[model samples]
Target: MAVEMEEKPVIKLAAICGSLRKASYNRGLLRAAMKMCRDSVIEGIEMEDIDISELPMMNVDLESNGTFPLVVEEFRHKIRGCDAVFFASPEYNYSLTPLLKNAIDWASRPPNAWADKPAAIVSVEGSGKSGQYHLRQIGVFLDIHFINKPELFLNAFEPPKKFDDNGDLIDEETRKRLQDVLLALRAFTLRLMKGKSY
Candidate 1:
């Protein structure tokens, strides 16, 4: 009898935070998500943070001159290399933050690196319902396949129930939900890769 070996498929996921602040609640949510994926037994799924704060605002003239900044190139490269993406956005004035929109615009230029990639968004703020709605509407035009269920909205201002003094996610329920989101993202990415409808 021959021994059989099983191989696990590796899924690469890129994550970005909409807020540039070092102590941003949205960034903390992404950290929690990364931790959940790291501690999971889901096997072969890896997530990395892509810093978008360094990207400059979109300028058509610069692009037309073939002078896309190094940061923009790196951002696009990460998106192109990843199997999926996770966006942790913070709502500002009932819409997505400028940082997140700028990053998205850079990735959607010309070749459109975001097209056909599986993505999920988790909004962390006082009120995220509006931001999530706006992001979804924009996502439709970007052609990114987003997992619609298990939509995560964490109220950072809810106090002692969810975040700590340092703004890290500490609630057990919210942690479980973050894990669920990661698992769902992995499953959906695999389904899309196999040309199956999720």
Candidate 2:
């Protein structure tokens, strides 16, 4: 007897963080996201593997030279290759951290790569409210089809401690939140891919 197989939808997601620190809460949140994503429609790409520190800021000379920094080029290529993005950002003085902002700036240069992509934000901070506003501002400017429902904010740094060093999510509440965001993001990504507003 032959068995039928389920068709898995290909949904690529590029994840970025607001901190370069090895132990950053934002990166921890990204790890949680990776844990939650479904195998059927999720492919999570972390930014750490792509070196962005070598890339210069969005400068005229860089473009004029017709040269693409391997890191920046990989960044844009990932964005272009993906169906959506998941930004795991930390709050810095009630704003998105500079590390994440620089990433956006670099990706949004002339010949932008972020336009019209469906995106979502999952912020982890000592205080959740502050991160909300910060992500809102970024969503507005990026023109991404930001998922409005099931917004996630890991308010306290303590929650991530439930997970192990291997980046597994252990806290029940945090795990549930991760599931909620993935479902919401999947719906949002599907809506955007279908050319419908959600």
Candidate 3:
């Protein structure tokens, strides 16, 4: 007699980078996480990035008609459909970048898409941990369920070797931490789906 093996559901995660620069280290870190997910390192998980650069600044004037821009709508749709979120923040002026804030503002409007979704944050910063802190504060208002352990606070400046010359994340230790964060996020999301609280 052959026993049937139960199949695990594929968890979809959406990643957002807080920087728009072409050579942003935060983006590189995000890419590394994505590559790991693509390689099936996380088991039954898929990850993709939703670009926030195209989102226009949050302006109430633009929403006078009670409609979000096409790009903003698309962003909200992606977040709403994903099982979890991953944010790679690059500290700017001791805080999250305006680009990322704008994207969040758009999504936090009516029918908040970020609500109840398990989230994780990683940052490539010099010394300021404010960016991650600010993200967590915002998560409170957005009702985002974030994994609080194993926070990835990588210092790209003082590191012996964080990224390669090509801006790819080459540090094995950091990569391992990122993988752990993703795994935690996967478990966290599954728990929430099963009506369990963190």
Candidate 4:
């Protein structure tokens, strides 16, 4: 006799890369994750790279009558729809990239789009390590619950080149570590959904 198996609910993830460069290592990490999901290597989750390049500099003047610009609204909508977030960013001058902060500000307006969402960060750092930490501080006020284990901070300049000319992550060890972080995020998100944090 055939038996029926219960299916798990799919977790929707919105991925954001701080750098806007086409050949950014941070961006490559996000793409690799999406591929993992497509290949079933990471099951029960769907991730979409949400582009914030179109958002203008955040300003209250832009919000008249409690309405934001079209691009800002769209970005906030994406954040609101996601069950969790996957942030791939590189620290700049002991802080996060301006591109990322601007996007966060826009979504953090009158209605907080990131409130209570589980999120994770995969950063590529070379000595200056304040970027991800700064992001974490921001998350506290935004109410974004970030997982506290298996942080993947890649040193792109280290031996065994992590990426090729295309900026694709080719290092097996890095991929494995990144996978671990993603799995952690998935588990944390599930716990949040079930209202159990253990």
Candidate 5:
């Protein structure tokens, strides 16, 4: 009998965190999502090198200068190279964070990195619904095929500190919800990669 090795799907995921706060709930949500999906069909991306804050505003004139900002180029490249994107956002004053929005603004120019890509949103904050709605608005203009089900809205302010310094999901229920979302997102990406429309 011959032993055969299983092949893993080459799923490149670009995770963007909306908040730049040192202890942002949104970043923690991404961490939770990655941990929960370790055994799933898709691989989670840890974009630790990219700085969302350094991408500057959406200025075409500035972009047309001598050189493009490394952060902007890297962000667009990540989105273009990846099969899907997972946005970990926080609702600040009932809207998406500025840090994440600016990064998206820069990436959605000229070539539009998010044009027709499969994407998912996760928000961990006091009001999860608010974050979700706000993020949806951005999804509309970017032309991102946002996932409609298995939403992960972690209520961090309620009970059980669901994250620590490194943004790890501490609660069991929250982890389960993140896992469910990842599973759905994995299937979503795979289907999209296979040329299937959702």
Candidate 6:
């Protein structure tokens, strides 16, 4: 039996981009995704950007009296509330960015916001895709379930020039691929959420 929209649980996806560059192509991918959701290019999912740029570098000393800093608390809260995660990861020395690692570390503390959550990753990079793999490895300990197929890794400097000067996706083909990643993430998230109250 087909599930009605109202009966099926609404999937919430929260995205965090690795690169903090103002005109980063990775950030552009995430922006395109939010636009697609707003325009109904993808259905049954509500996507939001979770800012990790403001997150401080990990320091055990930052924890005071069993409480985190205000910004860390807010970031952890958002990750905890989302049904799944979308990572716009860009390679840096064949691994995830330090900023992203910091965010994950904060959230993976006592309560572990990422535990048992479904996740998907998209990237725009030079050559090495090892960054994506590095993230998946981290996900193992964090319990972030990632969808295996339909991975997105584009050459941002390729001939077509898929993004504009201000870091917005400008090409239709890349937009479609981004949409595909979102749809797959949504489906995988729903599958994990089935028969359970999240």
The model with the greatest TM-score is 4
RMSD of each: 2.5, 4.2, 2.2, 2.1, 3.5, 2.2
Query: Where does candidate 2 clash, by residue pair?
Result: none
Lowest lDDT sum, 10 consecutive residues, model 6, at 2-11
Model 6: per-residue Cα lDDT over 93-185, one tens digit each: 999999899899999998888999999999999887899999999999989999998989999877888989998999999988888888888
Regarding TM-score, does 3 or 4 come out ahead?
4
* TM-score per model over all chains: 0.91, 0.79, 0.93, 0.95, 0.83, 0.94
By summed lDDT, which 10 consecutive residues of candidate 5 come out lowest?
41-50
* CA lDDT scores, all candidates in order: 0.85, 0.69, 0.88, 0.92, 0.74, 0.90
- Give the winner by TM-score: 2 or 5: 5
lDDT by residue for model 1 (140-163), tens: 999988998899998776755687
- Alpha-carbon error at 166 in model 1, in Å? 2.3
Model 1 misplaced stretches (Cα beyond 4 Å): 1-6, 64-67, 196-198
TM-score of 5: 0.83
What ranges in model 4 sit over 4 Å off? 1-5, 196-198
Candidate 4 versus truth, CA RMSD in Å, comes to: 2.1
Query: Residue 167 deviation, candidate 1, in Å?
Result: 2.2
Structural RMSD, model 1? 2.5
Candidate 2 or 4, higher TM-score?
4
lDDT of 3 at 195: 76
Q: What is the lDDT of residue 88 in candidate 6?
A: 96
lDDT of 5 by residue, 1-198 (tens): 999985546666777887888877777777666654554423543333245767778777777553457777877887888778888887888887778778888878878888888878888777648867877888898888888998877777787777776766678887777767777877787777777534
